[model samples]
Target: MKPMKLMKEIASDIVSLVYPHICVGCGSVMPFGGGILCAECRADFDEPVLDRCPVCGRIIYHRGKCRSCNGTRLYFDRGHSVFEYKDNVRNAVLNCKYRNMKHIGRYFGEIMADYAEKNALCGFDMVTAVPLHKNRMRQRGYNQSDIPAAMVASRLNTPCVSALERVVDTKPQNFLSREERLKNIKRAFAVRDKEAIKGKSILLIDDIYTTGATVNECAKVLKKNGASRVEFLTFSCRAED
Candidate 1:
């Protein structure tokens, strides 16, 4: 090994011994070196049931498309998510988005990559993220979506493209009811490069999938600009029913 690299590894080990990297979920030190969650937390991380709507991937009791997507329609053909947005998964997302635990983002990204590889995200020509508005971007320092997109893109061996822009600073979806969320995000996003996304399959990445308002709007815009297909993968989603 290069002396410099070996020295760096040694230095990291020494620092780790003094201040170990702890799992955010349970506050126990991580036993392995790959991700933020400890082995037990990773094992405990529950996968959502496959009872989601085919179009939105939110849990549905006895149907394919949820009521919203069934009648209203969406540009994105389908959506998939790794875990339900509750308990440890919810806390992990909050930490990743607001608490600067970027490692958690990478961990969730790996889960998404594994899921995509095993169950096929159809034909994603490129990966992009649902953009945060400019002001939000400045406030947050980084887009949470980028971490997952980067990991999945690297694993899938496809290009990661930042092809969409949130032109308007919309309110947090958590603050709004479902009706307001739909209104707040409508027309807030715009395509940045028509040539890049035109006739290409796009996989949109985000931290959470709630009402499907944001992703649906994003998919609509992408399709309008000639994206061949739009699909999405989120870390957490609520029960569709």
Candidate 2:
């Protein structure tokens, strides 16, 4: 490399050791500096504007139940998310899951906790996360959902329970169609401790909600094993066009 380039690299290494650049959204250099996202990009994050279904939390064109959940029997009682899955929020979520940016999970978890409190969504008896199959967990070295679940539980002053387990290692839900996703996740999860969850309301944590297949299947197992109720909170969801 050129002498100047080498000097720049050495300087960057020194700065990293001292200051340590960290921005969860967009990988931008934080100027005013001290949060997950840079100030400008943080302002660009969008919240959902459309009315949502009470049960599924998908955007509804009208004021009533969403068409997606109108005829379907959902296992979870309700669901909600902090941001629409797009732009800076999307980038943050992707980095959190794929790039080992676990701090983003804790940051988003705090935000979700605030949202849950404001919306009166803190009625659950316990908190838990959708479990990864052992093989997948081994590959990833972590179940990404667990960090946020624990953080949210801490904020809510509730116990974070590892109450569900993935019995079958399934295909990534984003790669499948709605029908394929539902079939792919069927019978995939089982309750780890039925006695602990019996008659208890569970708040399930996840990173994103797409077709709702994964969380719904998890809820199915939890409810079948005696959880009195199952509801979910996620970082983002499919945006309604």
Candidate 3:
């Protein structure tokens, strides 16, 4: 190797030794160029979701709606999640939300984008992220879904429209039971642009899916405002069974 090139490599190694990149999923030091998730975390996360319920997108064993959707009236036509909310995936999402690791959100966005492409989940006129209420946005400094939603839109070469707004500042859905979640999230969102939404297929992106109350409510608002079709994609889904 040339002397200058060797020196540059040495300097990079020294810099990395001083300030190593940490894996967002496991909080371990990442090898140079290993990216956000380390090898083990990647292996745990990238497995294809198998036997998922088509209606609510929860991983399931049999056909048709899973337990979460079997008895309920849903607003969104259908939805799918990239990973079930557990283990490393769960840790990463919590880190993104609580620890304010924006890069982790972006990493999930790229993962979602890749999943969309591989699964042929395109054809939406616009992509959107579930919005944060103004108060939450102020407290959190950013919507965790926004960067990933925009990245997915960029992958599809479509516009990422801010088409919905959260009108109510409800309690976090994680703390509530399914019944309570439904009550807490009811009518929480409103469409921002009926004209843009009318007759358009919308792809909504979020970080996690639990009882389906939140995204279902968003879908209800979209359809109510005349959106032709509403589908949601999330980084993880709760495996209730």
RMSD of each: 5.6, 6.4, 7.8
TM-score of each: 0.85, 0.87, 0.89
lDDT of 1 by residue, 68-115 (tens): 777776788888887788777777888778765655666788888998
Which lDDT tens digits does candidate 3 get at residues 1-241? 8777577567645643433377777888877777777899889997767788878789887777798788888888879899999988998899888775666776898889998898788899999999999998866667999999999999988899999999999998888888999999998999887899999999999999988898999999999899999999999998867
Q: Which ten residues in a row have the lowest lDDT in candidate 3?
A: 11-20
Count clashes in each candidate, considering only residues at least 3 apart in sequence or on different chains.
Answer: 1, 0, 0
lDDT of 2 by residue, 122-166 (tens): 768999988899998765556778888988888888899999889
Model 1 clashing residue pairs (backbone): 59-240
* lDDT ranking of the models: 3, 1, 2
In terms of lDDT, the best-performing candidate is: 3
Each prediction's whole-model lDDT (CA): 0.81, 0.79, 0.86
Over 4 Å off in model 1, which ranges? 1-20, 28-35, 47-50
Q: Who wins the TM-score comparison?
A: 3
Residue pairs that clash (backbone atoms under 3 angstroms), model 3: none
From the highest TM-score down, the ranking of the candidates is 3, 2, 1
10 residues in a row with least lDDT, candidate 1: 11-20
